[model samples]
Target: MNANVENQSPLLRNALEFAKANWWMFLLGGILYILFGILALARPASALLALAVVFACFLLVDGIFSAVRALGAKGAEGRWWVFFAGLVSILIGLYALFGPVNTVLLFVYVVAFQAILFGVSIFMFGVSIRKAVSGEWMLYLTGVLSVLFGLLLLWAPGIGGLSVSLMVGAWALVIGILRVVFAFRVRSLVRNT
Candidate 1:
């Protein structure tokens, strides 16, 4: 029993070390999301159009990947959903790419739906983290923030869409930056630990 406790302690300590190293990356991502929201709000119409094109490009790439994966699929019959999702994503992308500015509603819907998913993911992570540490309230706070933001997005689809797009853009920008920062920070961890 003493040996087991000693073994578990290092594992838990290492896990906490990992989380500490990564937490700043997530916070940076949140900051970026806030900035994106600001940008989208600045020019909703143009941003919407730009976003649609970006999504279209992603869908086209995703479709190509999905089709390739589908072709190589083995006995996994459920692989059809991947192909189907890829097709639908491609079609939606094309529609948004060519459709008028009024098609911005699609963008709005995507933002709201993404918010809900993000909220749920955060909430689940928070709950799980609560079990890991006695005073890990930050996760809970983050989860609450995520859920609230998601709900707010759902409540106002148009504004939510604009907000979410900006937020997500900012988030990606921050996350990307943080990842670069952390990459440098982890050099010692890579070498020593």
Candidate 2:
């Protein structure tokens, strides 16, 4: 192990050590994420509810942490802002927990708006780069597709919710597989070392 460490660059050695130590965490997280993705894909309605509950819990915890940090940071600049943000997060968390359906709808609306804004930005970028970059048309195409998808979501938010769930599921599954692969790779590194 010492010889192997000496042969590697300092950054690579540290990263390998970190990965060796944390490989189990990656494996566990990957399994959990894969299960979550499967469940979300199999039942999108349930996924939405689960997502809302999870988000609420996360917000509550984050708010509490932020509030504590703000209170602990006596005489620190912008501490009040942190407290204010925490309060808002707590309120929103409570609302989301109690009014899940409404929260989901709101999330869908936000996603729609975000997609539209993203599409417009992409389109603008494509236009800006038209003169300097070839294949700018691909960006324009992607922007158009994004805009159309957003418009469709606005037209039917129920479908949008399902789409969001599916997308989240697919993303989670892909990330889970990557993590699992990484865990095995790290384990191999440990063995090699």
Candidate 3:
């Protein structure tokens, strides 16, 4: 056995076990990602209001799952941070869902801030448990893309509805695909167990 596997922290070990049992969850999540990614890409120039609603739904889903994963984790290291990140996501989702957005640029800065925080938290968690399983690095890459997406939003908040849609669409595509890959790898790991 690999020394690293034997020496895994309790948190990492438990997380791996959880992942093994929940491989199908990841697969379902992967399908959702592909669907959502395609949605964002399909209508790159969709109206700001429509995009905002879609994004809000996406954030809500992300937040709920994140919180569920964090809270349900057996020994997740820094689990509180994950909860915090989920909370931030929820709040942002709520804002995006209901907050006034007469223009495309309205929530850009706010969303950017939330995205940066979410990205940092995700990256940190990924690093914390990277050695626990295969394909975990993809989580880190997701964080990197997330952070970059946020920075892009921040860098050009006034880019308009179409551009924002495109960026969001592209980000969703890559990150969702990464999740799909990570999920399948975990599935295979579980199958062999």
Clashing residue pairs, backbone N/CA/C < 3 A, model 3: none
lDDT of 1 by residue, 96-193 (tens): 56765355566666544444544444444334333334433444444455556557656766654455566556543443343334334433343444
For all predicted structures, in order, the TM-scores are 0.45, 0.49, 0.87
Tens digit per residue, CA lDDT, model 3, 113-142: 766877787687777667866556787888
Question: Please, what is the whole-model Cα lDDT of each candidate in the order they appear?
Answer: 0.48, 0.58, 0.72
Which has the higher lDDT value, candidate number 1 or candidate number 3?
3
| Superposition error at 24 for model 3 (Å) | 3.8
Give the lDDT ranking, best first. Answer: 3, 2, 1
Global lDDT of model 3: 0.72
- Kindly report which residue stretches of model 2 are placed more than 4 angstroms away from their true locations once superposed: 1-5, 55-102, 105-159
Model 3 worst lDDT window (10 residues): 1-10
Sorting all predicted structures by TM-score, with the top scorer first, yields: 3, 2, 1
RMSD of 3: 2.4
Best by lDDT: 3
